[model samples]
Target: MSRRTAVIALTALAPVSWGSTYAVTTEFLPPDRPLFTGLMRALPAGLALLAITRTLPRGAWWWKSAALGALNIGAFFPLLFLAAYRLPGGVAAVVGSVGPLFVVALAALLLRERPTARALLAAIAAAFGVSLVVLKAGAALDLVGVLAGLASAVSMSAGTVLTKRWGRPEGVGPLVLTGWQLSAGGLLIAPVALLVEGAPPALDGRAIAGYAYLALANTAVAYWLWFRGIERLTATSVTLLGPLSPISAAVIGWAALGQALGPVQLAGMAIAFGATLAGQLPSRGTFSPAERNGQELSVDPRIPAVRR
Candidate 1:
């Protein structure tokens, strides 16, 4: 497969990995102190990655990885768990869907990419669709949940952009970058985990399974594939896949969590999904640095690296 296609294919994994967190939290994890759970999810998974790689970045990457880790994994993970704790499953999922929109704005500003009107419309539509799916009349929303979800979106969005702008440096594998961030984020949260929640208690069988999936699959494997894609694709185009997260979340909710969606919710999802696709079309606006800066569509980052 082409690099760009590989990027799309790989990026698609992130949301699916993320989607499983909710089900795992509800079904397996201990039912207390979400921050504690969040910190563990980050620390152990990150440390596990570090153990495997057994390598670290040199020079500027040392700090770059730390910064990226704090923004992407550290802050985002805890906020995510807290939001899930505070809000309804659907509500959290809906708010999380806003990631793509934040990515759009960040891309336009930071990456200097010109967004097609369609992509903008798609981002808006997707946000609206997420609301329809999750929100209902008279639902009481928690301020903390709202802030947490939005914060997760922004932190992740910025990480996505930065990843594109300064992808994995030469000879530095994506796995290393993933490990660095995971470790950094984990260490950052260690104090909080100790102070507020303390170390993880014993795990039940189900919790063990959940931890395995989260640490190995979601953190290690998913991130490996993601940075592999990031190395190959532009951040903006790659982020277009952000909507897949909510779509996968909804599916997991339906299948795993026994959550149900009616016709309106389905329609909203369709419109949201369609709009995202339309925005990425070359006809709307090819996501390239030059195209974003009003220059020209010379290279499409989503193309496979080998092909490029």
Candidate 2:
């Protein structure tokens, strides 16, 4: 297949894997204490990568990496859990759907990507759709959850732009960046996990397996793929795969968690997802799919190629 298609396919895996997080956390991993889960997911993954890279941030890179780690992993994660706990699955999904929309605003400020009218319109519609799907009459919206989702969006968005701007230093690969952020975030959260939660909740075998999957497969490998894809493509284009997270989460909830989606919820998902696709589509006279994916990477439509 073409390189663009391959990039798309590989990028898609990141979110599809992430989609399982909520289900896995609720069903398998320890419950209630959100910070602990976030801590465990990030720490080990970070340490493993650090060992492989043996790379440390020299000079200002130290603070930069730490800020990224905290913003994108440490803070974003627990907030995600809190939102998930407080909001209904679909509602939360729809709420988080605004993430890509938020990226548009951030990108305009950070990446200098000019927002087209179509993108803006679609984004606004997605926002309204989220309001419809999540905000019920007489049911006051959860301010904390809303803030959490918005904060996660901002953190992740900034990370996306900043990662591109910083790029990887010479000899540093995406894996190292992934590892550093994960490790840093993990280290930052460890003490809090100790003082606040103390120990992990009673976890079953399934929980252990789920945690392993989250750390190794979802957090580490998935992020590696994500950075690689982003490197090969534009930030907006690469991150467009984000909608897949909620989509996958919705599917997992339906299939595994047995969480049902109403017609309105489904419509919201459609609009939100549709907006993401529309926003990411490249204009004519850009890199082709094959050109983007080097020979080593086979292009697969099943993978979300974030090709520019």
Candidate 3:
């Protein structure tokens, strides 16, 4: 595969791994410890990456990493777990599917890229498709859970756009970036978890195994791939992949858990998957004259180009 294609596939793995979170959390994790769960998922993974990479954020990156980590992980994780705890998994996933819309808007404001009509439409369709796939008849939604779900989406969307806008410094790899953010986020969560949750929940073999997977594979590997993708792909393109999380969750439910899929859900899957593929296509008529003439497209001067 071409470099770009390989990068895209690797990046896609992040969300696909994330799709398993709802199932894992509900089945294996201790109940009502969102803060502690978030801390465990983040800090260990971050520290591992830091050890592997042997790198630390310098100067301005210290604060920048902290802020980004707070938005993406510290704040986002607890809210996500709260939503997952209160709302049905499908409802929470459906709510989180609105992230692309937030990304589109944030990209315009943060990255100074004008939102395309096609992308906007795809975002809408993806949300609708996810709702069809996951929303069951008589699915009860808690008001706080719904708000938390939406807030999680918005928080991550803002982080995504900002990450794209503030690309990594020269010679810094995505692994280091991932490590920085994860560690920062973990530190942010530590005090909060201690204050709110008091003590860590007791873990059996199954729960320990689940947390291990989340820290190693889901947080470390996944976020590394995600940050790497953000460096290469447009923010909107990255966020468009959010729909796959719900779809993957639904498939896991069907195949592994024996949850039955209805005709409408199947159709919704097709539509959402198609929209994801479409969203990856480069926007037509977006290339500047230089790009049209076979030169590299110019990035916004405000946003630093990521060095490969």
Candidate 4:
């Protein structure tokens, strides 16, 4: 495969793996320990990546990594778990599907990339499709859960757009970038997990397996591919892939958990899947006046520069 194709496939794996998180958490993870679960998911995988890469952030990267880590993992994780716990899996998935819209807006404000009409439409269709597939009649929604779900999407969307805007530092690879963010996110979670959650829950063999999978395959490998893709793909394009997570989750629920899917759910899945494919199409026009005139959006200087 071409390098670009390979990168897209790899990046796609991140969300595909993430789609399984709902299942794994509900089945195998210790209950009532969202912060602890987030810590385990991030820190060990990050530390492992650091060991393999043998690279440490220098100068501005320390803080930059911390900030990105906080947005992408540290904050996103606990909130995600909270939503999952309070909301039904479908409700949470539907709420999280709005991430692409958030990314499109943030890209315009943060990266100076005007939102394309096609992308906006795809985002809307994807959200509608996900809602159809996941939202059930009479599903109760908790206010706290809804807020957490929305906050999680915003946090990750901001992180994604900022990642693309800054790019990576010269000579820094995605693995290292993934490591920095994961490590920083993990560290941030560590204190909270202790202070609020008290201690890690005892794990059975099944829970241990679940945690291992999350740390290695889901967080480490998946994030490496994600960062690698962001370096090459437009942030908006990459975020368009967000809908796939819910689709994957829905499929897993149907296939693995034997959750029955009606005709409407199936139709919804098809629409969401189509929207995701449509979102990947290349933008077909010249740069907007703002971009042509070097009016690129600038992030706060306090944010560390990314390697490009």
**Model 2: residues with Cα > 4 Å off, grouped in runs:** 85-91, 125-139, 284-308
Higher-scoring candidate on lDDT, 3 or 4: 3
* Per-residue lDDT over 1-308 for candidate 3, one digit per residue giving the tens place of the 0 to 100 score: 65556667888899889888767887888987878888989999999999999999888898889989998998898888788888997789889899999999998887776899889988998998999899888999799999999999998998898788777766777899999999999998999899988988778999999899999998999999998788667788888887888888889888877888999999999889888877888764334454444443324446432234
- TM per candidate: 0.85, 0.83, 0.91, 0.89
Q: Candidate 1 — which residues are off by over 4 angstroms?
A: 1-3, 283-308
- In order, candidate lDDTs are 0.72, 0.72, 0.84, 0.83
Worst 10 residues of 1 by lDDT: 299-308
Global Cα lDDT for candidate 4: 0.83
lDDT of candidate 2 over 257-307, digit per residue (tens): 777778986887787677667755765323544553342221222234333
Which structure is stronger by TM-score: 1 or 3? 3
Q: Write the per-residue lDDT of candidate 4 for residues 60-106, one digit (tens) a residue.
A: 88888998999999999888878888899778888888999999999
The local lDDT score (0 to 100) that residue 283 gets in candidate 1 is 41
Give a tens-digit lDDT track for model 1, residues 53-110.
Answer: 7887889988998888888877887788778778886788778877877877887786
Q: Between which residue pairs do clashes occur in model 3? A: none
